[model samples]
Target chain A: MTMHPDVAVLARYADGDPGLDEASVWSVESHLETCADCRARLAGQIPDDTRALLDVVGAAVGRGIEAGPAPARRRMAIRRRRLAVTPAPWLTMTAGVLGCAVLLHAIAPDLPSLVLLLAPVAPLPGVAASWNRRTDPAWELVAGTPSAGLGMLLRRTTAVLAVVIPLLALAGARTGAPLAMLLTPCLAFTAASIALGSLIGVRRAAAGLGTVWSVAVVAPSLATAQLPVVLTPGGAAAWAAAAVGMAGFAAARADLFRRLNSAD
Target chain B: MRTISAAETAPATYAWAVHAEQLKVRAGRHLAVDGLDLRLRTGVHGLLGPNGAGKTTLMRALATVLKTAGGELTLLGEPVSGRGDLRRVRRELGYLPQDFGFYPRFTVREFVEYMAWLKEMPKASIPAAAQRAVERVGLTAKADAKMKTLSGGMVRRAGIAQAIVNDPQVLLLDEPTVGLDPEQRLDFRELLADIGVDSCVLVSTHLVEDVVAACTDVVLVNEGKLVFQGSPEALMAHGEQGDPGFSPAERGYSALLRRHRGGAA
Candidate 1:
C-alpha cells in the first residue's frame, strides 16, 4: 500500500530527520490528496505527541494556578460596580454642611460670613475625589460603562450645586442683592474649588493641594474685600459672569476624570 | 445584506450546559481564546490543556465573567451578552475560579452564604442552601471556622461548597480538587458524580484520571484551540487495536497516573 507523503513528512518532522523543507511539506500535501491510509496515520500521531508533552507541563504548573485566588480583572470589575452604587461618608458630611447652610440662615438673621458658605465648597470637591481614590475600582468601572464620564461628574457636581445654590440664594436675599446677583461669588468659588480639586486628583496630586489652593485664593479675597460695598449692581453682574466661567472649568475637570479612568 | 423581519425564529434544541461559537478574548497583546467553539452537556466534562492553552479563559467565558471579544456564546440556553440574561443564566451557574479566595474574616458558612447572595438567592433560604452545600462538600463541621483558620485543603473544600450551594444547573470548577488529599479527592469525584445527574459539571484539570473516573466526556484544548473532544474511553481507544485496548502497564496509562497523581490507573 502506498503511504501518504503527509504521514511520511510528519514522521520526518517528529524525528527531526534532516533534508525536509518547504518543498517536502508541499510534496506531502500533494501525496495526501491521493492516499487515505497514510493520511490517517499522520493525523493520529501528530496530536498524540503534542498532547503527551502538554500533559507533562500542565501537571507541573497546575499547583500555582490553583493557589492564586482572585485574578486582577475580576477584582477590578467588582470594585467598579461597588463604587457606582455606594456613596462615600464624606458625601454625607457635605450634605450635613448644606444642612448647616440652611440652618445658619434661619437662626441668625444677618447674612452669615462668605467664609462659612465658600469654605465648604473649597474642600468638598477634593474630599469627594479623595473618596473616589479610595474606591478606584468603582470609579474605573463607571468610567468603563457606556455612560459619559462628563455626565457622571456633572451629575455629582450638580447635586452639590443644588444644595449650595439654594442656601446661597437665601444668604444672597438676606444680604440685600437680587437672588441671581448673590449667586456670583458663591458659585464662582464653588466652581473654582470643584475644578481645582478634580484637576489635582486627576494629576495624582496629594489631597492638601485643594486646601492650599483655597488658602491662597479664597482666604485673601474674602479678608481684604468689603463684600457689601463690592456687591454694587455692576459688580454683581460681573460676579455672575465669573461664576459662569468657573462652571465651564468644572465641566472640563469632569471630562478629565472620565478620560483617566477609561484609560484604565 | 438582507434585513430579515421577525417571526422567522428557529429555536435551538441542543441540551448544552455550555455552548459557544467563534468565541474570542484578547488581553493586551495576547489572544487568549480565539475562534473557539464548545458544547458541554451532561456528566462531568474535563477540560485538559497546557499552560496558556486558554482552558481557564474558556471557563471564565462560560461563567460570564469575561466578555468575549467576538462570537455567539450561551450558558444554559441564555445569551451571555445582556445583564438580564446573564443574571438569569447565572442563577443556574456555579463557578469555582482557578484561584479562588474568601474574606479572611468570614466563617465558612458566611463565605458560602455570601456567594449564595451573589447568586441572588432569597434571603430566608440562604442559610438552608448554604448548609446543604456544606454537607455536600463534607465541610459542615468547619462551617463555623474562619476562612483564614482553614488549611489549604479545607479552603478548597470551602470554595467547592460555595460553588455548589445553589444546586446550579451548570457548574464550572477550575481545578476543583487542587489541594485535597487522595481521600478528599476521591470524595470530591464522588460528589461531582452525584451532582452530575441533573446538572452539567465542567472540571478543568491536568489530571486524566479525574476525566477517566468522573467525566463522561473530555475536551482537550491546546494553544487556544480544541485538539480533541470525546469520551475518556474513546480518547484511549483513538489509536488502539481491537476493542480500543488499554493496558495497566503502558505509558499511556501515564495519562491516568498523572490524573490520580501516581495512584492506581
Candidate 2:
C-alpha cells in the first residue's frame, strides 16, 4: 500500500531524508489539497525548534527595521512626559531662596542699595544641586538609550530655567534692580551652575559640590563690592551666553560618557 | 560516513535554553556571581542554595535585569548582552524576583496587565491574557482585589501569575511558593506542571521537597559554583550512601519518615 504524499513528505523531513526536492514539495502540496488530518500533522511536524529559530531571526529583523527612529521618538515623548510630571524641585527651592532674599532685603536696606540685588544669585547653587540630584538617574537611563543626550539635557535645563529665571526676575524687580541686569547674571550663573553640577554628579561626586563652587565664585565678589563691575549689563550678558554654551557642552559630554559606559 | 536515521540524529536544536559562561558580577567589593557557567534545558530545574549563595544574582542575570561584569550569555539562541536582546528574549521569559514589589494601589489584574505590557504583549490581548493567568494560578476571585489587600500567599500567587502571564518559554521563579500553605503549594505545582509542557520552568529554592515534587532536574549551586546537576532521585541516591536508614517511599507517612531520616542523616 502506498502512503499519502503528505505523510511521505513529513516522514522525509522528520526521518532525515536528504532527497526532498521539487517533487517532494509538489507531492506535499497536492496531498494538502485533499487531506486535512495529514495537513494538520504536517503543520505540527514543521519542527518547533526551527520555528523558534525563525522567530528569533524575524524578531531581530523587525527590531532592526524599527530601532532607528524609535529612540528619537521615545526621547521626545519621555522629555515631554517628564516635563509634565517632574516635581519642580528647582521651583520650590527657588521660591524658598527668593523668600529668604526678600526677607533680607526688608531687614537690611544696605549701603549700596543694590546689596539685596545679588541675593537671587546666592540660591543658584542650591537650585542647581537640587535639580542635578533630582534629574541625574533619569538622565543616566536616557543616556543609555540611543537618544540625543543634549536634546534631553536642554529640555530639562529649559524647564528648570522656565521656572527659576522668572522668579529671579520678580525678585530683581522687588530689589529695585533693572529686570534685564538682574536676569542676565542670575540666568548665566544658574545655567553655568546646573551644567557644572550635572557633570560633577555624573562623576559620582558628593552632593553640594556645585553649591560650594557657585558660592565660591559669588561670595568673594559680594564681599568686595555691593554690585561688582562684572555685574554690568554687557559683562553679564557675555557671561550668560558663555555659561549657556558651556552647559550645552557639559550635558552632551555627560550623555556621551553614560552611553559609552553602558555599551561597554 | 554512514547516515543516521532522523529519530537517531540527536536533536540539532534544543541546545541550552540558557547558557552563561564566565559570568561575573560585583556588588561594591563583594563578588555576587563569579565566573559561573550554567546551562538549562527543558523541564523544571530547581536551583538549590542557601541565602546569598548568588542564586538570586544568577537568576537576575538570566532574567536580564542585572548585567554581568564579564560573560557571554545566551538565552534562546540570542546573545543576552546585546542591546535589544533582553527585550526580545524577555518576551519568552518570565521572572519572579525573590522580593517582588507592586504598586500598592493597583488591582491584581492591573498589575499583571502592566507586566504584560512590559513583556510586550499586545495591548488588546492583555486583559484576557491576564485573566487566563489569574485563573491558572487560582486567583480569579482576587483578580479585582487591591494588591495591598491580598495575603502574603495570595501576593506570591499573584507574582507567579504575572510571571507566567505571557506564557513564557522560559519561566524563572525565585522562591515561588515561599508563603503558600501545603494545599496552595500543591496547586502551584500543578500549575507549573501544566505550563511546563512547551516551556522551560526553573524554580530556585533551598526546599528539597519543592524540587523533588516539581523539578525533573535539580541543580545545587554552592558558593557560586554548580555542585550538582541531575534528577531528585539521583540526589537522594547520592545521599543514601551516607545514610543507610534512608529509603524512598510513596506519599504520606512513609515519605515523611524518609524525609526526616534523610534530613537527620
Candidate 3:
C-alpha cells in the first residue's frame, strides 16, 4: 500500500523550497495528479498571498488560450480564415458558370467560343458578392469595423480570385481554349468592376459591366461569328493595362467604400 | 485678461470621446442629422426621440458608418472628416445598428471572435475575449449554436456580445432593447452599466424607463436637433402633471418634445 507524504514534506513542496529533494518534488507532483487528498493538503499549506499569485497566473494563462497556436488551433484558424473570406454563394455561381460554359462548348460546336465569351464576366458575381450589403447582410457592421476599408475589400477580392482563377484554369483546360484568353479578360473585368465599384456600389458596377460586356462585345461577336478585337491574342496587353490602371484607380479612391451610399 | 493657452485648454477639449459641431448627415436626400451639436464622455448616455427624429442617423454617424455631410465631428480626439483617422478611430469603436445582419452560419462564439478580428484584437486573446463576451451576454450555452438557430432575443444578446468583445473605447447601440424580453432587458441594463464604466456607450432607444434605470444622462432630439441633454433626474424634473406618458421620465420626454415643437413653430 502506498503511503501519503508527511505534512512537513508537503509544506516544503508547496513552498517550492530548494531544500526539498528533487526525487521528492517529482514524486509529490506525480502523486498529486492522481491523489486528490494530497492536493487538498498541499493547497492548505500555501499562504494566502502565494495562492493569490498562483491564481492570477492561472487566470492570465486562461485568458491567452494561445501564446503560440497549437497544431489543432492552427488548423482551426486556417479553416476559419477560409470561412471568413468566402462565406457566400458567390463561389458556387463562379464555378457553375464556368462548368456550364465547358458543357455548352462540348454540346455546341457552332457557338465558336462560349467559354471565351463568358470568361471576362466570370468573376463579376464573385467580386460583387464579396462586399455587397445585400449578400453579406453584415454590411453596416462590417463597414464600421477597423478593417472595413480598401484593405478588406482587396483581401476579399483576392480570395474570390483565388477560388475563381483555379476554376478558370480548369475551364480553359477542358474547353481547349487559350489560357490568356480565359485569364487576362477575367482579371481585367474584375479590376474594372472594383474600380467602378468605388464610384458606384460593387454590385451595381458588376451588374452594369456584365450587361455592357454581353451587349457591346459578346452579342456582336456571336452574331458575326468572329472573335472580338479585345478577345484576340494581340489584345491581351490592353487587358493587362486596363487591369493595372483600374486597380490603381480603385486603390486611390478607396474612400468611396466608407460612404453610406457606396457602402454596398 | 489672459488668453487661454492651447496646453491649458487641451484637457477640457480632449475630455469628450465624441464631439460634434453643426454636424450633418443625410439619409438618402433628406438631412437626417442636421445642424446638431453634441458631446459625450465616458458613461452611458441614452438617446430618446420619436421615430423620424434622426436617432438612427445620428448613431450611424457616430459609429463611422455615415460620413459627415457638413460639420466637424471628432472621435477619440480624431476628426471624422479625414480618411486617415478612420482606421485608428474604428479600432476603438463598436457599433450595433438598429437593424443588423449576420452570416447566419456562424456560431455565437465564432461571430464574436470574427468581430474581434475585424476590430484587430490581438490574435492570441480573441478566444478568451469572445468567451468572456458570450458569458457577459448570458449566451454561454448557445455559444456553439449557429446564429440562425438562436431566438430573436438570443440574437440580440449575441449582437451585444460582439459589440463588447473588443472592449472598445466608444460603443454604440441603436434600439438595442427592441427584441429582448423583460428579464433580458434588465440583464442588458446591467451589462450596459458594466460596459459604460470605462467606455462612452451611446444607446438610442424609445424606452424612457430604460434610460431612467440605466443611463447616467439622457439626450432628447427632434428633427435632427438636440432638444435636451441632462441627467435623468433633471429630465424627470421637466415632467408636468398631465403629460401624455405613463412614467415621470416618459412624461418629461413628452413635455420636452411638445416644448421643442412649439418653440420651433
In model 1, which regions exceed 4 Å deviation? Answer: A1-264, B1-14, B81-84, B239-265
DockQ versus reference, model 3? 0.46
Q: By lDDT, who's the top model here? A: 3
Scored on chain A only, each candidate's TM-score is 0.44, 0.51, 0.70
Please give the CA lDDT of all the candidate structures.
0.63, 0.64, 0.86
Decide which is better by TM-score, 1 or 2. Answer: 2
Q: Write the per-residue lDDT of candidate 2 for residues B207-237, one digit (tens) a residue.
A: 7777788888877765566666778777765
C-alpha RMSD for every candidate: 24.0, 13.3, 9.8
Q: Measured by TM-score, how close is model 2 to the native structure? A: 0.59
The digit string of per-residue lDDT tens for model 2 on A109-158 reads: 66333423453354443344333424433222122222323444455557
Off by over 4 Å in 2: A1-209, A212-215, A218-264, B1-14, B82-85, B241-265
Q: Enumerate residue pairs that collide in model 3.
A: none
Better of 1 and 2 by DockQ: 2
Cα distance off (Å), candidate 3, residue A118: 1.0
Candidate 3 residue A209 C-alpha distance from true site, Å: 1.1
lDDT of 1 at B17: 65
